[model samples]
Target: MSMSLSTLGALIDTDHMLRACCNNPKCRHYAKLDLEYLAVKLGRDHSSMRDDLVPKLKCSKCKSKNISLILSAKSTEGLGHT
Candidate 1:
């Protein structure tokens, strides 16, 4: 009637997971980097020095139009890291 610790951990991780641009507080989106896409645009794999705008047009959690045209490495964490 009870799940194992590993199963519980997996469930917890899945439930708290957030997509790349979700910008939620209860996920690891803040710690991840979209390195592949960033590399293509920058023409290099070194993402640290690449200074180009990553265009994104999506809705925020508040259902507001969120348009971002800034560096990809910029902090998108609205509610801080999870």
Candidate 2:
């Protein structure tokens, strides 16, 4: 069976951060930000928040609407042990 894609709420659980990347092929710049802050930046109700963010989100370099969001740092690879 095919797994369904995760929604914005699923990506941000009011704790972990998310990675925002430009969808433009020529400009693949990205930035890591707090999920709660991102939600605030987008404004409006939580419903359809993902859709709302798309139009408002623009790449700093290319200024394109093609933006992608994904989980940040899935692995503990470079982090020093406590």
Candidate 3:
């Protein structure tokens, strides 16, 4: 059994899309806006862009899972650091 060229190409395209989605700055898991920028520059649809690079954090300011993004990180430093 052998896959067709289109199948192989589809697989590669899927992988690339997944990687692009993962690297998107709006992703809650990581911060990389360049991916989203590139996606927009390429004239990708906004709906697809939203699906691929939606902002994971409800609050970009704080980036807190429990609280709003407005939460501050001021006191989160290593107090015991020598």
| Cα shift from native, residue 41, model 3 (Å) | 5.3
Task: List per-prediction Cα lDDT, in the order shown.
Answer: 0.32, 0.59, 0.33
Report RMSD for candidate 3: 15.7
Output the lDDT of residue 44, model 2. Answer: 24
Ranking by TM-score: 2, 1, 3
- Model 3 segments beyond 4 Å from truth? 1-28, 39-41, 52-82
Q: Model 3, poorest ten-residue lDDT window?
A: 65-74
C-alpha positional error of residue 73 in candidate 1 after TM-score superposition, expressed in Å = 17
TM-score of 1: 0.22
Model 2 per-residue lDDT tens digits across residues 1-82: 6522243454454334456799887889997745566557654244333465567667778888788866554454357866
Reference-based TM-score of each model: 0.22, 0.54, 0.17
Local lDDT at 38 for model 3: 43
Task: Give the CA lDDT, 0 to 100, for residue 29 in model 1.
Answer: 27
TM accuracy, model 2: 0.54
Q: Model 2, which residues run further than 4 Å from truth?
A: 1-13, 34-36, 43-49, 73-82
In the order shown, the candidates' Cα RMSDs to the true structure are 15.0, 5.2, 15.7
